[model samples]
Target: MLSAVPRFAKIAAVVVLAAAASLATFDIADARRAGSSGFGSRGMRTFDTPAITRTAPTQAAPIDRTMTPRPQQQPAAQPPLGAQQRPGFFGGFGGSMIGGLIAGGLLGMMLGHGFGGGFGFLGLLLQIGLIMLAISFAMRFFANRQRTQYAGPGASYNNSAMNNANASPRPSFSIPSIGGGTAASQKARQANDEIGLQQADLDRFEHLLTEIQSAYGAEDYATLRRLTTPEAMSYLAEEFGENATHGVRNSVSDVRLLQGDIAEAWREGDSEYATLAMRYSSIDAVVDRATGKLVDGDDRNPSETTELWTFVRKPGSDWVLSAIQGTGTH
Candidate 1:
């Protein structure tokens, strides 16, 4: 009974350690950024993946929270009747045999008889290792066979052509010249040809970047409502409410646009939408509401952030922020 107690304690310790490791693996740090993932509407393009650009090469997180209903994907065509089906990793006669072996081994271990009814924990481990080694060998063999089959006459030429096609140059946008009208005009012209964005538009975007940050930090609802769309304002308001609940306030200031480029620009009916990837530095932090003591982030030093901000406007109307997507940066 004393020996059993020690064994049970050891098992409990291992389980606790495993649970801790699992929790640590899935832990994510929360930031005070507008929207960490994609949200809000982007007109008809809400469900479509945005074009990859120089600024944000990785795929932006999909619009998880939006008014737009996603189009249902077409079901894949069924294979022809009686056609031989390709066996999956754990499918068909071979897979069943392997699965049975594994299950039998596990049952043996549970029953204190070990794998194939003899060697105990060490035997179980050895069986698992051998099974894994067999799987690895099988996968490699199949991979090599497929490679050899595809390595026919014009394979090199086909591969070279594919590489060349994939290597097509990405469109480049000129950085807007701050405080210089002439330079801004030239640079804006050099921006994405499809968008037809002007120097004034780029200026507005930069201005809003600073303005919105300041307003959010100050908890100025009026300013936030004026600068952002109704949908966006609601999100900001929600964040503010959450902060108030937590007894903390997000303090943001000293915002400076480091680099920016238009990822995409398109007109949807009466409204025009432009998604810009902007990298900026700001002294963004959280402070205790009551004590005014810093809770998170550096108050003295500014931190850089890269994000995709989508702005919308109609004819003769000023641009307003519609959506903000983080580039997976804190």
Candidate 2:
């Protein structure tokens, strides 16, 4: 009876060891990174919070320049006219006037020499009269054109002096100054308002850091899209797709913020952006999507990491994640 009892005990021990090994194997298989770093593709901006940073990782192109202001284009200059159109008896008269004056002078000289020894001959007198008439007509045409341009259409020379007297005054504007005593006081008040806004930004940054990780763990891509910029969302979607292809999933939980500090904040056009360096601890694990078995990262161990995140918001708008940068795990 004692020998039989010992054999049974040995069989039971072997069964117990086999069961433990099976459980260990179950815990070892897990999905790959489901979407770490919020899947943001914004390049290694690190401390770069500028709006001009690349929208995706490894991209070497310029950023969208829509936020920058540009000068308005001025109208093109009109080409000068080489010739003028003439109308009625005086049409194209500038050349005619010059020609007539020369012809009349020659006729007058010839007539004067033959009829009155170049003194007071009737023919010469007639030619001199014609020349004077042509000169007066040319002067009249020039004076009329000048009046038409300045005084506008349908204006009459009879009231030319009256129109000049009634011209409207030049425009005047009063500009507000920012250097005087009262202006300086206003500027100081504005600075105080900016301080309050920055505090709100800090609060938002902390909230997003936790919320974004939770969404990544859950593989809630829709939530990520709403919280992050289009570029960041696309990058995250790609990570999710890669995980799906490999039949793996990442799990993150117990996200606790350890420390955070603002690197910089500035307004561009109607939007404001902030860069933050944050240290945090979280339980991050990869598992098999189909079996929910842990693949990597100790489920019992929480990790500490440092990262830089940038958020942007417009007036009366909610903050959205624009970028993420990672530092090595601690």
Candidate 3:
């Protein structure tokens, strides 16, 4: 009885350790998925946070001028008019089934090969471990392949060579100083102009938000590459890489710009800032690209779910997303 107690204690400890290890692996895998190159074929993008800044003169006129000519420069790349349909959901389920079968077969082989003195208890555990490892690798690989397919072909072209070509020259504008009027008129005009500019900014921001949401839905990471901050870009790239190994893909179903209010807009020294609150949805999923297995759901996907994204605008610069905070959804 005394010897048995010691052995039982040892076994219990091992079981506990194994459970803890599995949980840890699950967390690591989660993080990896966030930074993984989805489906093993995509790259990651970095994400940054909003920072404080000082004020600068608004440059509205040049933006209008540049934007007009810009649209005419290139023909819009339209998807086949009928290409908007969602990919078949069963694709993911099928891929998952296949992965499971492969993993099970591997386990059977391990057990059959005298893994545990006549394929007994110890052998069964060994086989389970082997199968889990195989499944992990398969998921990772399939995820990468699928991600690439969804992201489309040669996305790098959009980020580097093509984007630079499309980028228009910087727009410039001058703000009239609020001085020299019977001080009262000066103040009133300044206030009026600020209100008008703020409204325009809101409109512009909303438009960008809509475009980004559309890009995500279409699995167009290339658009995100240009619009998102460097930090966001890096984070996304890492996420794409890790997920690609597992055949995972993120699909945002909708993004509603619930609100867009100015937080701040100014220049500290040479840098400028424009902070705003953007409430939206980011319906997403982790799925097997080839088989379309739905591995998970994004908290921002459902109609009831919401997310917060912040944008930063430098003095004489374009607005770029700097942060994305989960609004009680993480």
- lDDT (0 to 1) per candidate: 0.72, 0.55, 0.47
Q: Which candidate would rank higher by lDDT, 1 or 3?
A: 1
| Model 1 per-residue lDDT tens digits across residues 44-157 | 888766655555665566676766788788897798999987765446776787667655644444444434245544554455556656755665576677677758746985
- Residue 205 of model 2 has an lDDT of 67
Candidate 3 residue spans exceeding 4 A from truth: 1-197, 264-266, 281-283, 293-295, 298-302
Model 3, 300: alpha-carbon shift in Å?
A: 14
Model 3 poorest ten-residue lDDT run = 59-68
Assess every candidate by TM-score. 0.69, 0.44, 0.40
Better of 1 and 2 by lDDT: 1
What RMSD, rounded to one decimal, does every model reach?
6.8, 38.1, 20.3
Instruction: Identify the candidate with maximal TM-score.
Output: 1
Q: Report the lDDT tens digits of candidate 3 across residue range 1-330.
A: 334333423443355347447845886777644521211100111122222111111111111101112223367577797786554332667567755554454344343432233555566456556655655676567767767777644587445534433544222111221112243233223331322234345555666777776775556778977777666656656666777777776666665555333433444455444444344545667777788767787534455333334455556777766555433322
lDDT of 2: 0.55
Residues 144-256, candidate 2: write the lDDT tens digits. 77666657434664355344335431111111221123433333233312323333444566679889999999999889988988877777777789988999988998887
Q: Name the best candidate (by lDDT).
A: 1
Instruction: Assess candidate 3 and give its lDDT.
Output: 0.47
